[model samples]
Target: MDVIVIETPQLGDRSYLVHDGVVALVIDPQRDTDRVEAAALEAGVTITHVAETHLHNDYVTGGYDLAQAHGAEYLVNAADPVSFEREPVTDGQIVQIGAFRVTVVATPGHTHTHVSYIVSDGTTEAVFSGGSLLYGSVGRTDLVAAIDTVGLTHDQYASVRKLVHEAQHDAALFPTHGFGSFCSSGPATGAGSSTIGEQITTNHALTDADEEHFVATLIANLTAYPSYYAHMAPANMQGPGPADLEVPESLDAAELTRRLADGEWVVDLRNRVAFSSGHLQGAVSFEYGNGSNFTTYLGWVLPWDEKLTLVGTHADVEDAIRDLSRIGIDSPDAAIGTEPRALAPDAPVASYPRVGWAELARDHAAGDVLLDARRTDEFADGHLIGAVNVPLHEILSRMDEIPAGTIWVHCGSGYRAGVAASLLQRAGRDVVHVDASFADVESAGMPMAEKAV
Candidate 1:
């Protein structure tokens, strides 16, 4: 009677490895199998089975590999129309892992093929809801159009009601994608695992609500999905697509251009305006989408061997790297902009320009206004004596706020300042970015002003 939840921070996707003495089961594994397998080996347990709640659009599923590696059964939802070497798990079928009983419940909504597994050590039933239900929200129903998503939402509403109202009281709920995922259609914070009843009472989307209302709510917030979905479907339907998912060894702009010409897909993780201005003639973008969340659609739409390169705005390569990785899309070398240090870190900072009170006074004395380009939260703190807050994410939205003149932008640790500089530069603004090195901050003896509120 042992259960473990492993969180992949890069993607905000959670995987579970449930074991009972001699028997073990791996659910919704992330990119790295070593960690899961290592845990099992360390615990002196054998991975008896591997299963996915559904065919994921986010990251590549590792169930087949785990099953192949361990000679265990690879289980998927029978409702999935795609063909695969899967043992169709029957609804309400109980799977054994030593003393633990894992029950299958076909809870389809996010996609037609998705399901949830209820694991109970005799008394407490914990549900592994792949994408059906999350902490304060429900799964997005728009991905799979095979079944009417509205109809599926209705069924999902009923399925959740059944689980919460009658099936298993105190059945702990575990979901794959949690907070900060595009697949999530409702509130996601303070979520790890919860009972069906807790979700029924507390899940805002499900509380005292009916099916029609649920469908409307889900539709309202859903943004224009990444275009990768066009490519991901066929890739998933084919068996064991590709295991060695890594970015290309070399992919400069020229190489990516060639790949696009050869009918391969290129997903630029840049914003809509930047993408619209100029991109690899055919490259589609989800720049606004978090790498992992949007990457699911990226992974689903592209082939394992397809030559793909990322064209993100300045200073998002690390995020781009991890996001694409979790969804099983390897990134290419030579990302946009110079490879800068991580967005923020605990030191004074790294080498670059320093703009302290002296320079601040000079700029302000010369009629220049300080531009604070961190995210809204970062700006909400304190800032320089006088600075205008313009977060990078919302800069494009508030282009009018930025007067047509030279503006200085700075962020904590100075990572986002470069991005703001690049974006503002693109928008034809005169921007001298304060790429402040940690040494510069210390040398200038500038007050450690909090970001603007």
Candidate 2:
């Protein structure tokens, strides 16, 4: 069997296309279906089946659309209450594609009806474990609901153990999450795929002492996932429509202003330094960089149905739209491809001053309000003394809680701090962007404290 791994680094997820030289099957595909389609063409095989391990909570699935387009059978868990027509699959059911045999194994943990598929070509075996058994970690169990966390954690443990011990112990394991994904319970010990035998020895969930201890550790380690996750389940249940890959038309300053008047989101896609130097008033900053979590933050903070106008270059706008589409954000209402200064020629521009670690320490000592924009767990691990732990995602909502003064915002790295500084400036607060490493905070002789329990 020929197994191709399609990686979505933006969301830190993977999809698989397994073929046996004549016919192929796709598992847990993202909304961008062209990649999978191209792979099938390159392999000289027809896509005969598209299967989903579960209704995804991190991004929209392309299984239904791809199946419909290719006239392939779409498979989903029989227990999931989806609105669209699908070939509902149950446990132990085997489907044949050319010389490959794909068997479904019920592994409910990440979601109530999650399953893993084992594909074999008689000689070698491969397991398409969507969110169950990851490389070195397991999927986080709390995305569904708070009440279901303990129950799901228990299921996750049993599911991983079953996959590693009972079913296909020698099969190669490929999971959708855990490479840098927030969906994982914790960071994976390493990258790339692992075999069931290897995971059985190294995976924490599979090697834990007991179910109770595993559940506790799993639940305690879950950080605040993106707010966008709340919309994914319902969207998946309703069956997301076909994605539109076309870029939107560019709007001028007057048109953008009118839209902004109607409460549309005007996102500035320039670097933090450019945004901090000067940007249109009220435009939120989300710098487009390699490591920037643009989709997560934008989707988390922006209204789902509101019109969005993005301000960036042609290349920047195209890249942003594509990245956003992975998470069900198909298109923006309009995109401004000109430079910010050109578009907003006469508009009032805002700016924020950047500060170094030494200056931040002096400001902190002088009673200036310091805000740590990292996650709460990071704050608990180690943070500057007297700094408020208002994570970047919660900054806009919790603006009232911030003291009325010059706020100095810093994240573990400087990306989020730049985002927070823009939001604070837009809110009419005097802000100083602490654009330095948080690791240097303590090394610079600044007082630090652990989170009080």
Q: In candidate 2, how many Å is residue 379 off? A: 0.5
How does model 1 fare in lDDT? 0.63
Give the residue spans of candidate 2 off by over 4 A: 260-263, 362-365, 450-453
Candidate maximizing lDDT: 2
What TM-scores do the predictions have? 0.64, 0.96
Compose the digit string of candidate 1's lDDT tens values, residues 1-453: 677777775456788888877888899886567678888988889998888887776555666767778888877777666666777886778777677887887777777667788888877777788777788877777777735877777776766665555347677777887655656775666465677778777886668456677777767665534444444445455544334434334345455546555645545566534443444444444453433234443443344556555655545655566556545455455346322122111111122233444565456445675788654544454555556887655665687997655677776655456545545654556666565543455456565565433
Q: List candidate 1 stretches off by more than 4 Å.
A: 229-233, 241-323, 334-453
RMSD of 1: 9.6
Q: lDDT of all predictions, in order shown?
A: 0.63, 0.84
lDDT of 2: 0.84
lDDT (0-100) at residue 406 of candidate 2? 83
> In model 1, how many backbone clashes occur?
16
Worst 10 residues of 1 by lDDT: 340-349
